[model samples]
Target: MTHSTRSSHPRRRTTPRHPVSPRGLRTLRATWERQAAEAGGPGGFHHLHGPHTHGWLLADAVPELLEPIVHADDDPLEPTFFAHLDAPVAEALLARFAPAHLVHRSNGSPTLGNQLRATVAHPGEITLHGFVLGPGRCDERLVSEGALVRFEADLLVTEHHAPGCECELLWAYAVDELGLDDAEHAPHRIHRIHRAEAPDETWWRLLWA
Candidate 1:
């Protein structure tokens, strides 16, 4: 005969779990990585856009200079070498790859809002997620239950706050989709600008001078 024993211990409630999606995290990681950009140097912000926007220096202003340097005729700039973009395409192309990338689709549309909102709620810190590239395609290979959120409070909100934010966020994934991930290895900085001043500025104007 076997005897069964029951313990009189009190039952404890388990903590609620918030599942994170592996797909959304891929883009989150890229954005958080920009925080450590101090090591790469200053131009991080300027290089992104300014007098000197492209890698080939004069190429950004004058696309003609890049035609010769860009050896590949079909896909002249295949993600690796940074030449100059046609002044015409420069703005559009960069916007296509701005923000975090993975969160955007091929046409450069945002794929997530709740995740982005959660991220903005907390600043200065980031949460890493689990997701791997599939079939080497950046499109829909990501597998996530839900994206994790990281809070990083910078002097300013990320420069990715404009209309380009949506497009740029998408382009990176497209490049990854195009299998151009290994093209450029250089470090890039995400611009951070403060928003606190906005409220103060508004108050000052409404009150005195």
Candidate 2:
């Protein structure tokens, strides 16, 4: 009867889509198993940004390394909000966002090569992170059918929650390609540091805390 803690069932989440950069972890897992079997799945595959996904996430350093670790607001490193259609109008707007989730930002740090900056948070009731780079698209499937698709990151944050309540925007992209002075996070590459520290709201108490 020592099972006072039975009826259990709560643990299911495995998300690892190509991320091996410990100096090319076994040649990047054999080139991500041959690019996920020639892009059959494994999420399209594409992280050759830095010396191949952040050159071992910046080998070794020792200064305030790896920041940013937001809690809510989906905080997945928030980015991918879009607009400034450049590269061939962003590939005809990714043929209707091609089922997207994006969340951009990746000048490919490890010393900034690809350069990134994305912020597109859309749900409803007005929420805009870089509001799709502004200049248009208030939502219509993201400009009349183009959900959102335009990569080539390299910037850092973005804001416009004006009316002065709380918009502590801080831009700092390609932080010298995130050459962390002291790093860690190589259990197969997955980042989002900062750990703790988030208490200062305003914009309606951070949109209702």
45-95 in candidate 1: lDDT tens per residue?
A: 232322322221111122232222232222112221222222222222222
Residue 199 miss distance in model 2 (angstroms):
21
| Residue 101 CA displacement from its true place in model 1, Å | 5.6
Candidate 1 Cα misplacement greater than 4 A, ranges: 1-113, 124-128, 138-144, 147-209
Error of 1 at 168 (Å): 35
lDDT scores in order: 0.25, 0.21
Q: Each prediction's TM-score against the native?
A: 0.17, 0.15
Model 2 lDDT per residue over 1-209, tens place: 11222224211232222333366223422332343244334343333441112112111110001111101122212222432223222222222122221223222211111111111121111111122211011111122111122212322322343364122221112112222211111111111212122223111101100
